[model samples]
Each structure stands twice: as structure tokens, then as C-alpha cells.
Target: MKLAENMLFKYGSGKVIRVLYINPFTSIIYVIDMDSNRWSYPIPKDDFLTAYQNKEMIEENDDIYCRAVPEEELNELEKQKRDQAWEIVTFFKSKLSDDEHMFISKYRQKAMKETMAVFSISYNGLKNILIKYFKGSQTKCSLIPSYFRSGARGKERKAGNKKRGRPRKNGENAGVNIDENIKKVFKIGLNRYYYNTRKNSLKTTYELILKDFFVKEVIDENGVKIPVLNNVKDLPTYEQFLYWFRKSLNDGKREIIKREGTRVYQQNYRAIIGSSTQDAELGPGTLFQIDSTIFDCHLVSSFNRDIIVSRPILFLIMDVYSRLIVGFNITFESLNSYSGAMVALANSMTSKKELCKKYGIEIEDNEFPFCVPNRILSDRGELVNGYINGSIQNLGIIIQQTPAYHADYKGIIEQAFNQTNIKILPFVDGAVIGGNSKRERGEGLDYRLKSSMTIEDFTKVIIKSILFHNNHHVLSDYILEESMIENNVEKIPIRLWEHGLKYKKGQLRILPEEVIKTSLLPSQSGLITPKGLSFKKMLYASKYALENNWFQMARIKGNWKVKVCYNPTDLTDVLVFDEHGDGPFKFSLLEHLSMYSGKGESEIEQIKNFERELERTGKERELQEKMKLFTEIEDIVKEAREKTEAEKNYSKSNSRRLKGIKENQKNERLLHREKAKKEREMEVILDESIEEEDEFAMFRDWEESNDDE
Candidate 1:
């Protein structure tokens, strides 16, 4: 590929504004700022090509070729430059206004003079230096009095002047320009034929790259020359090897590398920079991030703190822009989409007043907003996918899901969780995060000995952490020129939110309370039986459902399939949607023999087992056997929740493991109570029949004695 001056190419940030310089060699290109100004330091051809994405083009030598600079980007860059120029003319010009001080034009001349003198070049170099001085961030340094940029440039220019012409290193001068080599070799290792997942580290690949050049020619028996490894001292230094090895790793960005396909990088490595919610569609109520993180602490059952339950999962929704926690749930329950999706969905729409109250955190009015975000960024959990996604979309809120296993996409909330770990969890009595240091410096710290924190206690800490993040955490704009905040405004998250809400109101949305509340509840399809509704292997018939003739009128399909919404937190009542006059009416259900909230889905399975057992035995025998079965179930769950979390059983998946342990424990106290009630009824009926027989026998005996006499 032939290269020339005035041709545009991509540099570091996919920007084509950095035009090729007036002075360029076959292997090098000079950096240029907007307005076609160039730098003394020449970028190597390989480095220029590294950043190419093939989407941009530049006109050179009457041929249209792909350039780092795209035609469309040129227009945008110029517009941006024009805006910056206006800002400089308005705000920056005032700083130079005293009559005694040099005029702005004079300062520009001085800055340009310093640049040309430092590069050891002529008037040709003067234009490039002057252009960069006014256009780049260096302008800010220039505006500061007593900040002589010339003094700093003298050292750098001397270094560049001395190294101006050495044997052209592939995109770098004689210094270890090993980046190109390492990237090339590392990519080769990424191929399935060369890359071995079972054994390959960056260090291994680094050594391999050095080995490629660490060869000496040797005479073979046939008098033909063969390349063989030289002495150990002849090998490339490890420092250079490691430096280039690390350069090959461009976190989540492998625009120039081809090795990602050899191994599934997506599952093993999280890209540091990719599809983030932090900067995307940010506003007061436009982007909300939802994620489930297990708190870095061990918690016990609220009923008993001495017994270790498990580290609870924190299902939270954070407003991406405001850093305000909208809604969350803390439980020792495993990752149920019901807890994850609904809690976040409800949190986005409803007031945090009730949520704060539940956790005993007090809040003033408007401390947090109750408006729903127009778009939510969530992981591909069961809730934001499949059927639940369609259900939530009905409320007119768009759901944007993060690609599988990409935690960076939801970094805004992940950062919030990190704050909770660093600040709040440490003070809590039983946090495991203390042991996260290298070499397990906190190995012997038995947090469980101090495991006095309950799920509710941890919940309070989370609320405080959120309040601290929103009300006190300082936020800064990445690009100050385009910040939503004015120079005079505070940068706290809550303050930013207030400002953005008042000014940057981009598609802010809020659903009606009923609509949002219903949206938050999990929906399931159920068949309306004559006995009421059959769902999850249990028969549930509400007073409203039975009274409305849901079963009789449901003969359209032989049985009507009704949409059922139930609070996972409370299974005592389910809302069976009766679409009559006033939306879906609430329904009070007759309690099933077993399936309750505490049992979770285990109750459904237990009920099925109980039914099967009853079929094997008669009703009376079944009742007696269930009394024993229920007692055993309670014992099992009681034992699990009460088990102390010792070091031996501690795991990262503590919440899930404990849930499995508890599942084995099976809480069938409801089953036991029902069985006892039926037993008592049977005893009364048996006693009354016996008494009636005794009375009839006594009357017959008395009549026979009287006749004989």
C-alpha cells in the first residue's frame, strides 16, 4: 500500500481529523490536528494501520481509498472544532483582556514560535505547531499565567530531534517497537491450530514472540543453513518481551487482533470497555441499569443470627445518570427472575418511600424520583427475556438487554455495588469481602463469629450506600466541552439528576401506579378448573373467581386460560385478572393445603408428592402419614437455615448453595397444621357415633326387662 502526505488515516480514537503531515516517509506518518497542522513526532505505518477499521476513506492522488478519516467524520469534526472555537473566543478570550497583558493573537505567535524552536525545524513546521496550540487541550495550559508550555516542550523536542532518523523501526524508532511483533504472534496463538486453551499465558506468548527472532544460522550435515536457537544471553530481554506482551492485550478492544476467535473470550474475559450504560441515553429517567449481585457479606436468618443462612442476593435497579437506587430486594433466595425483574421494574416506577420504610431508612420528600425510565438496561435474565420481556414492554418502556456475560454493559450499577463492598460491607459484622485480599491476608477472620447481621440489617446498609452515592458522590463529565452541567453547577449525582431533569428531559416516562404495579408482578398462564384455577400443581380458587362463574363461562376452550399475577414475596393471595368492568379485580384465595411463600417452588413439588402419596393410601392413612411427613420437612429446613457458616463450607455461590441446603430442609409446617385439623374432625365424628349406639342399646335393654316382669 502506497502512502502520501495530505492522506487521512485513523489514529488512536477512530478519528480521521489527524491528517497526514507535510513531511512523511514510506514507513512513517506525522500526527496532525484539525486545520492540517502536523507534529515533529512521526507515527509508524504499522501503528497507523493498527487503528484502521476499514470504514473510513480519504482522497489521495486522484484515487478514492479507505483512509482513517471518513468523509462523514470530517464534517462532524469540523463542526466540533467550530463550536470549540466559539467557546475559546468567548470564554478564553476574556482571560487575556487586561490592557497590560499581550493580546490573544500575540500569545498565539509566542506559542507558535516556541513550538518551531523546540522541534529544531523551519517555517514549514511553524504552521502545524500554531494550529495545535489553539485547537488542542494545550490551549487551557496556555491560558494559565506562569504556566510556560515552552519550558516543558524544550525537553521533549530535544529528545525527538536526537532520534529523528534512526533505521526506521516498523512504526517506532529504535526503542522496542515490539508491539507489532507481539500482536502478530499473539494473534497467531489465538488460532485453534496454534492456541492451546489448556496451557497458554501472556508470558508464554511473550516468550514465543522473542523466540521468533532469537535464532542463529547453523550449518547442517547437508551444508544447508538451518535457523536454531542461540545462546540464552542472545535472547530478547524479558522486560521488552513483557512490555509488548501487555501491549497486545487491549481490554475489550481487539480491532487489530484476530486471536479472539480461537478461544471464547466472551465467557472468560469481560471487556473493560464495551456497550456501557453510563454514557448511553443518559437523563433523569431515560436509562436505568438492573443487576443482581450477592452482597459481599454473610447473613443469618432474621429469626436467629447465630445460625448462618447465606450471603443474600442484592437485586437492585440504579438510575444510570443519577446514581440513585430506585428499587431493590435483599434475600437469601437464589437468583429468581421474579425477584430480579419485578423488584427493578417496580423500583423504577414507584416511590422509594415504601421501600425505604421497609428497610428502616428514612427519606425526605423528592429525595428520589418515582418516575419510570423510558429505557432500562438490564442483563439477559429470565425477566427481561422471553415472555416477561413482552409483558413489561406493554407498559411502553423499552427494555435494552446487555449481551450475555458482559458486565461492563451494566457498569453503572456494578460500580454502585462496588461502593457497597468497599464502604458499607466492611463495617457490617459478617462481610466476606474482607478476605478478598491477595494471599488471603484475612484468612482466619471468621466473619461468621460476628455474623450478627440479618438480611434487613444489610438492607439498611445498602440504602445508606445508595444515598451516599447519589447525594454525596462527586461525578465529572468525561468531555467537559459538551457537559450537561454548567461551570457553576455542583457535580454530585443527585444535583446532576436535578439539573438534567429540568433541562435534558429526553423521553422521560412514567406509567400509572396501577399499570406499573401490575407490570412489576410476575405473570403466569393458568387453566381455570371447575374447582377454580389450577397452577403450579396446586388448585387455587379465589372468592371473586368462583363468584364470577369463571369456570362455567370458561367453556370457550373447554377451560379458559386466564392470566395470573402473583407476588412472589407473598403467595397467600394471587391476583386473578377478571376483565369485566373496572380492570383486573383483586381476588382472595382459599389457602391450599401446602404451597406457601417460604417453601418457594418447593411447596408445589411437595404438594404433587403429597397427592401421589394420598393416591397410594386412603384419606385417613394419608392424613396420618402427612403428619409425619410435614414434621420431617420442617426439621430439614430448620437444620439447614440454623447451620453455622464455618470456613469449610463457605463459597462464592453461598446464596445458591444455602438455598439448595434449605430446599432439602423443606418447610412443610403448613402441611402439618392442615393434617392435624382433619385428624381432630375425624375424632369428633367417631366419638358421636359411639355415643348414639350406647343410648339405643340402653333403651332396648330397659324395654325387655319391663315385659318380662
Candidate 2:
């Protein structure tokens, strides 16, 4: 694709530049570099296309680019906001001169900028106050802000199409009645549009609006009335009802406001949808719920144990029908699909026996589950584009993406998260109240400052929460929660899970370990070179992978895209599946990743970014230069310990990540030692007659004896 506004590109100064504004006339793009420095540079179209072709630049995923401001600048902004917020309000009050402060609604939205130009207040600090104070909230005799405009559509419509009076009523339809019949239809349509949890279309709402207005009979909002309209002859046109339905009686923005207020209406508005009592034919492995939420608790560094850090992210997967959590992961790492898919795959394949043991959770044999769901119901996040979606598709699992904000689609899991958090947070130190402040009881009690729980302990708490939620907490699906115990049916989510396992219609498919590993890990189509599998700008091979000169034979496959799946958590190994000319597809691990053995996926990303910068300057850095760059990064981090470290957010995140890498490397070393010991010990008896000779004794003699050349 050609260069455009908001596209991310590599610059010659070794910076990743994000395009802020592009001027087509001058071919100049205003960009903010990674260091938060701005630049306006002109480039020819040919060069932009060339950069794309060479993969030196990339397009935006979300169509919006942003830059971090310098910390000093951010601090100054906050200071100004604190100091001048009320001053600007006073300035506006003086300008008002006792009369209500009148301005165009358009002007009101942009008032902060104008105020910033005059009195200089921080937008972040003043935003909430501005909304309340200006919108006529009388806080201690403060002047109210009021506005006049065409109608609700003033913002969505073009300035040219604007009319003087209310725009909702098509100029001729002003005499519409709010009679019982009309009001019934109006509400039916309105509920579907704004109130109902279902994602309804305007066409459907319009049809319902017209039909109820003409054909159907229903009670009005008032109990005493039937037909509020005195005459059927005087009733408005079908077209007019359609207009009013869209308009919501001159407040068409009502629907827009509610929708914008909460993007996931499914969870937030499930009661309106009436899904709290509706039960689908669901069981274990029917629908998997996957989502990521930052924990409400703070954490400390693993080594230091005193320094505070930000909340770690929890990626959860649950069985919707049984209300049982299937798999989950807790990491101080960045929230992304990498962690999301890992948890999804683990939920499908890995048992929680080891996890429960580590976390000190006691559960009955059937309390927890490891069943692959038939469908994955999730938002259209990066996880959908990740390996989980494709891998599940191969296993015939339908992936369902609900309309954004429709929480009812995954209500059970949503409620599960809330219940889990509520039960777990109070006992833990440094826990944020998550909008419910009852748990916290102190002044100057910064939860972020009070952090003492390590990531591991936080994980233990989370695991314990999930187990308690699944096994002990009584689920109230399709019934009143209070009545669940009185109903005398199966209560616990695990009981429901056990029942589902025995009676659930769908059969579970268990995949092989190799298949799970191959499918779950991030993969690329690689070419098998003579040395090894050439992948991700690096080569990897194992002794077994190179057995019988398979690498050389792999080239004969010719044009076939060899599938290679590598764990980002460990770049030292990549599992490869390749079909050469003669034999079946061979599955092998390419363990020798050269000097990249101990690198994490994030570090690999760093290297790719560094390479992109070097490529932009028409130069290539060798392995030594690349290693030097990493050293510089390390030195920068070391310097940051004393000079730049504030709270433990980034530091703990980085430390936890490095700790994971070291642990993985440590395991890798142990595995190598074990592998060598196994090689020295492995022996096969040649003949039955020779079986008399002890293989152990022969091996021992061979180990003790030195051979002459």
C-alpha cells in the first residue's frame, strides 16, 4: 500500500515514525518519532511505494497513530490543569455576566481548547469538571452552560443540510400524537434501537415501528389507556412514524449516546435483552469465553520484593454453559494475542492438575475441566487474527464474534470475572477497589504504593479465585440467584460441568501434543535450506532434524511452503513440518537457533525494529553490531534504575519478562544435560545370543575405556 496518514514507518535516524498528518499537496507528512520528537518531511510517492515494497515501512492496524509525550511535559500539563482548571471556569463565568452562558453546542465541545488558549488549563484535569459545570450542574452557585442548535443531528450532519428548527421531524410531520397506540409502537422501536440488548438494525426497528403503529394493539406506558389517538383518520403517515422512530421524538442522539456510553452492550445491558433467564442448549466445549482484564491488585518485584508495580493482566477462558473456567494465564507482560492464544490453547489441551498444585487450590477430580469448545465466542480482537482462530478452525470449531458491547453474548463469563475479582481482591494487599471502594479503608493509601505481593503470589490468588468460582460458587443461570439453592437442583458450576460431560451432545476431540504445539505457536511459511529451516530472518536446526540429510532433501520439495511453528517465549526452538519429494511429512524440532537461543519474542521484535531502521539508511548491521545495540539497551535500563525509575510498572514488567527468559533458558540447559545423559545410556541388544551380555555392563566398560585411534 502507498504511504498514508497514521501509517508507521522506519526513519533513517533509527526511529519508528508514526505519520500524524499528511499533506497531499506538498507530499509532506508530519510525524512523531519514537522519542516523541516531531518532524515534517517531504517524500516522493515513488519512495513511499519503494519503502513498502522493501518492507521497511508498515501500515496501521487501528487507523490511528499516537505518540507518548515526554514525562516532563506530561508533568507540566498536569500541574497547569490542577492550577488553572477553576481559573478558566472563573474566566468563563466573568464573560457570562449573570445570564446563562450561551454558546453553540458545537462550540461547547471545543470550549476547552478556547479556554486553554486564554487561561491555560490541562485538558485531562478540566475535562470532567467542564462537562458537569457547563451542562448546568449547579455546584455551589456556579453559572450553568447552555446551548442552542438545529437539532440532535447537528454533529452527524453536514453544516449545509442543517435546518433552523428541530431536524428530527421531517418539516411537514410536526402534529404527531403521543397517543397510547403511537407510544406503544414508538417504545417498541426505541427499545430495539436503544434499550434492547440485541444488536438491532434501523430497518428492523423502522418496520416494527410502522407495524405496531398500524396493525398491532398493545397497552400504552400509562395503564389506563388503549388508543390515545382520538381518530384513526388523523393518524400520522407510516413514513412519519418511521421518521419519529429514527428521531426518538426529537432526541435521536439518545440511542447514539447509550451505544457510545458502553461499547459492550451485551454484558452491560443483558437484563434489557432478557437473556438472564434464557437458556441455550449449552454444555462443556460448546462455547469458550476468552477475554483479558488487568488485575485490580498491585504487585511487587520478584527479587527486590519492596518496589511497587502496576497490575498484571489476566487472560481468562471459561465454559459458558457450565460457568466453569477452563484455562487462564497471569502475566506482567503486555496485553496482546500472544498471551490470549496461549491460554486458549491451554484451555483446550492442557490439564490444570499442575497449575492447581502450584497455586495451592484444592478441587475434586471433576471440578476443573480441559475440554475444547465447539465454538469460541469473543470480540473481534487481535486474538481472532492470532493462531488460536486458525488452529481451532482446522479442528472445526466455529469462531463467533459478537457485536461490540453486547455483553449478554458472554454474560456468564463476564459475571464470573466480576465475582472472581470481588471474592479475591479484599484479602490481597495493594488491591484497587475496581470502582467499589468499600474494600479499601485508609487515607494516603495508594494501592500502587502498598504493593508487596509478587507476581507469583498474585497468580496464586487468581488461580485460587478461579477454582473457587468454578467449584464452590453456586451458579444461577436462567434463574434468580437467591432461588438457586431453594430450587434444589445442581448448584455448583462444577456439578453442571460434570452433568454436561455425561449428557452434553457434542463429543470432545483430543489432539496430539505435537499437533497442539504445532498449531498453537505462531508460525510462518519457511524455506528449508541446506543448513536448517530458514525462518524469521534466522536459521534453526536440530541433530534429529538434520538426520539422513533431510535439510538437503527438503530443497527438492520446491515451492512448497514448509510450516514452521516457534514459541515466542522461546526462540531457541522451532517445530517444522515439511514434505520432501519421496517420504511423508517429517515433524522435527530445529533447536539450534544460533546465538538467538536465549532471546524472548519481545527481544526478537526489538531486533526486527532495529533492522528496519538500519534498512531505512541503506545499511545492514552484522550480528556484533546488533549485539552492541542490545548492550546499549541494557546500559540504558541499568541507568534507568536510579535516574528514571519512578514506580515499578515498566521495570517490573521487563523484569518479569527477563525472569521468564532466564527460567526457560535454565530449563533448556537441564534438558540438554538430560538429553546427553540419555544418549550415553541408550543401547539396543543386537542378537538373542548377545543378550547374555549385560547392556549396562557393556555401556559401563565403554565409558571407562579409552579407544586408540
Candidate 3:
């Protein structure tokens, strides 16, 4: 290799040197030892070339040997040091001429001392700066202070009997050395007092340590227990306590979780690495976030306007890339169950035309596009179920469940809920405002009583809100791609979605509506009984089952179980998949159970419970009535037996008593018929007599009035 200035070479013994100056006229080279930052003796050019050729010396890249620090990473002190060094080096170089430069390269003590005095820098400092400048290719960054290496990071120092750190001032006693025993005490105190939800400050924890570990209780002469502190000189100081506390609990996450509650820390204190859309999503439909929140307003029942239905749970599915709310479901179903999540997911993958039409809202196809996402992110709620995971996976969709207590993982949907509420809730009647404390203090009218909108009406309003959000609402903080900017696309959800479809396509997968419904609908095992398909204690029938005589076969061969999928929000029909690959078919409720036709799962359960309670009460009343009738029969039997016992010695033989039994029975029946006819005649005569008396009295009063006139 050709020798040049600032070139590095490593000797056979592994000592590295940088070429400071090369003199072709004298056939000599000047270099400096990089490790010691000192000048080395001059070497003959021929000898150096021989060593390099013989493999006794190897050429090294200066970049590997020289340290370069970024200016931004430098602290104030480091920057000042670097500037000072650069100024000194610049002044020294300005003073040197071409002749003096070569002379100084040979480590001339007289010239170096004179220059150092002029520059107000020590001789060694000047020499070190010169070595660094040449070795680092004369870059200003090479002079940055390496204070990071000053304290010997990662190197443990053994503590001596003397205190290791700075001593106290104000004539205070010097603190004792912290040994293994003292470290143990510090750990115990920290664990007991500091790392807990109590949130004790460092000083409070140190005081607690002093009180508990460094003080002893003594009985005074007055028979009172008094606390006595240990010698101040022998006790560990507060600084040592804090230092060891941080060192012992070095993991930030663990410390946060211990200091605060896990839930609080995760919700408030945990570091957010990056947004899901920017960090993980590629384009629209690549990733979707699904979450559910309780709606802020109460709603009236659609059937009974007087009844107030509690707040409905709003399930939203938003595209992570475009922040477009692809689908949503508003229902009374709770967020804990997978029912609402499944419905929301199914809605997300299917067309929203019917949904919008049902709510009487019109929208274009492009306004709310429905497409299956490659991955769906959700909290550890509904979508975290094993069955849901399997079902979604079968559709070639990946399920990403967020860590426990980490709701921010699906923050896109969470934010959408908040935004939707903020836009519409203010105008809605019965909207929940402020915290529960306000309600407890009776600040306003009862929200439940003020509710006026039904679920359907509220759903329509939400659809309108969503439409506005998708098409017209501007996303001020939305990040745009270079292509979007070039095309002058507006920062709106619909525009972003349209652009994504045109440019970044293929992330969206479209399946048939029926397929998506069957896959995402919540499923449960139903029994095929003689009555019908028994599910949730409700009987259902299908045309296929009727034609195949499934019920008839079940009647003969006992009931069997099969997996069935159903929409919990509407239990009128369920889906049963055929094992022989005929596809899933709908099972409608049996005609005999028409009362439960439009009822949901929870409503049906409640109705069944009410009916059961009624049956139990009716059975109890029937038992009481039957007991009273039996008591009357017993009384009649006793009266007849008493009359027989009172009769004097008059006994009829069994044959005599039985003789003419048929004739006697006929006579008795005729007499009873005659008696009933006479009683009916008397009742009719009495009613006629009462009517005639009233008529005669009216006539008499009219005649008297006429005579008086």
C-alpha cells in the first residue's frame, strides 16, 4: 500500500501508530503512537516499507482507530471542551510554517514548549491534540470530550472502610461505609416502604429505614417506651439509601409496576413506543383495530317508549392506516362476550348497504367500503377467546391480542369511540357528562328519565356521524405518503381509502357475505332433539332438517349434538354447518315458540325464567285448593257415619239395601230434575215481579204528577 499522511499501521506486537508527516527528501517518516497519544521516533522509509512488505506491520483503516462523536449527542461541557481544543489546534497550526511543521513532527521539545506557552496549553495537551487531529483526519468531531469513559462504566469498585463518595459538609459526622449487611437492610427497607402503591417519596423511605433499622426502643424510668437512634456516624446516610434503592430495582417497567398499580402504570406511565398505524400498518386494510365502549347516552326501548334501556355498547372497527371506521355495531349486548365482537367483525367484512338502509341513511359504495383486513388487533377482551381465534384464522385473518391492561394497543378504535362521542353526545339527551361524582351529588336531571331516542333512532344518528367522519371530517394529524402529496389527495379517510385501493392494493380481501357471516358469527353446540334443534332452551327447525327427517330420526335414535352458529342479537334464526360439505343452512325458531321469535338471547333467557316462576307459583296454588276440597269430603263422610251410628238397632241386609238400586236411582234422578226445574221457574217469576213493580211505581208517579198539574 502507498504510505500517506493520517494512515494507520499496526506493528507485529499490536502497537498502532498513525503517520503524522512523511519526508521524501530525508527518506524518513514521522508517526505518533495512537494508544499513548505521544510522538514516536522517526523511522527510515526503506525499513518501514520492508516491515510492511514482510507482514511485520499491517495497514489499518483510520476510521477503526479514531473515535468520532456526533455533535448533537455531545453535552454542553463536551461541546465547550471540543471548541477549546479546536481553537488551540487552529492557533497552533496558524503559527507553524512549512519548515516548522516538519520540525515539530520530530517532537522538538523547544519548539513544542514555545508553542504551548503561546497557546496557553500544556506541552502534553498540545501533543495529544495534534495526534488526535492527524489520526482523526483533522475533523473537529475528533476533539469531542470522551467523558462517557471517564467513570469506567460497567466496572464495579470495591468499597473501602472509608466512605466511597463525597463527604458531608457543615461539620456533620461522616456517614459509615455501606457493606453487605447495610445493603441488605437497604433492600429490605426499599421493598417494604418504597416499591409499593403507597407512593412514599425517597426521603420518606429513608426516614422509615432510619426509624425501623437504625433505631431501637428503650424503656425510660417513667415506664414509657422511648425510641433511641443509633450513632449518626455509624448509620448509612439518605444518599446511600437512595443510591442502593435505584440500583437494586434497576428494571424500569418492574419498578413502575411495583411503585404504582399495574393497571395504572400500563394506562398512564408505560412508554408508548410508536403509533400502531405508523409502526405496524402498511396501508389501508393491512391492519384493523377493533374495540368496544359503552355509549354515553341512555336510550328508550323501541317497543315501549316509556322504558329506558341502559347505554348500548358501541363496537367499532377502524382501519389502522387510514383511520377509517369500516364497520360498527350498536347493541345492548355486553362487551365481555364475544357476541358483539363477532357481529362487529362480520359487519366489517360485509357490505354496509343494508345496515345503512335499515337505519334510513343513504351512502355511496365508496363512502363506507367493507373489506377483510390481513390482521386484526384487539384488547384481551372478546376477540381473545380461543374459539374466536380459530374461526378468524380459518378465514385467513390473523388475530393480534394486546397485552393485558394495555388498551392503547388498539388505540385507533379507542380514539374513534371518543371522537364519535365528543361530536354527537353533547347534543343528545340523557348523555352522561362528567364523572360519577357529579351524578352522586345530584347535579342534573336523571339521565335515564331524560332519554327519548330509541335504539334504532340512536343507531341512525350514529350512522350519520360515521358518514360525516369518513367522507367530510378532516384528519389534521393524518400522515400522508409522498405519492398522496403528489396527487394532491385530501387528508380525509375516504380519500386515503380510495388512494390506497388504487395504489397500495392487495391488502384487502373480499369474501362472500354468507361466508363472512358464518365464520364470524358466535357458535355454540346445539342438541338435535325430537322436538327440534334445541339451542339455548329454544327449539328451531330448518327446511333441510325437515326434508331429511332429522327430527323423526332423533325421536327414534335419541338426540345428538352438533355445532351451530347464531347471532346473539337476533335469535330468530341460527346457522348449522353440514358435515358432508353442503354449506351452512339457517334454522328458524319452531312455529309453536312464536312468542320468542324476535327476542334476543338474554331476553329469551329472562322470559324462560319468568315463565318457570309462574308455573311454580300456579302449582303451589293448585296444591292448596286440592287440600281444601279433600278436607270438605272428610267432613261429609264424618257426618254420614255419625247419623248411621245414631240410628237404633235398624239394620238393613246388604241384598235388601241393594234391591231396586237402579229403580231408586232413576226415581232420585227424576226428583232432582223436577226440583231443579221448579227452582228455575221461581227465579224467573221473582225477576218478572221485580220488573212489574218498578214499572207500576213509575206509572203511579206519572199519574200523580199529571193530576197535580
| TM-score ranking, high to low | 3, 1, 2
Worst 10 residues of 2 by lDDT: 63-72
Q: Is candidate 1 or candidate 3 better by TM-score?
A: 3
Candidate 1, 202-245: lDDT as tens digits: 56665665556567788999999887876654344555555434
**TM-score of candidate 3 versus the correct structure, residues matched by position:** 0.54
Cα lDDT tens digits for candidate 2, 1-709: 4332334566454556554333444454444454442223345556766776877766534211211111111222343442254456655545543211223234443655667667555765455454333221112112211121113312322323233234454445433444456656667667666454565666666555555555535487786546343344445555655655544353433454464445443455422322322333544666777777777877776435665657777778877667678877666567655644564465545566755664576555355667545566665562546335544543435567656567676677677778877787778877786553233555655557667797667777777777777778876554423333454547677776655554542334343334445545555677767766677777766565666675667667543356666655445656665542111133433445444554445546655666687686655446668889999999988988867556546746656766778789999999999998776666432453366667767987887785631
- What ranges in model 1 sit over 4 Å off? 1-274, 277-282, 304-306, 336-339, 362-365, 380-384, 434-445, 476-487, 525-562, 570-573, 579-582, 587-709
lDDT of 1: 0.54
Clash tally, candidates in order: 6, 12, 0
lDDT score of residue 216 within candidate 1: 71
Best candidate (score: TM-score): 3
- Show model 3 residue runs off by greater than 4 Å: 1-274, 279-282, 298-311, 331-336, 355-365, 401-409, 427-430, 437-461, 482-488, 579-582, 592-598, 613-650, 683-699
Worst 10 residues of 3 by lDDT: 65-74
TM-score of each: 0.41, 0.38, 0.54
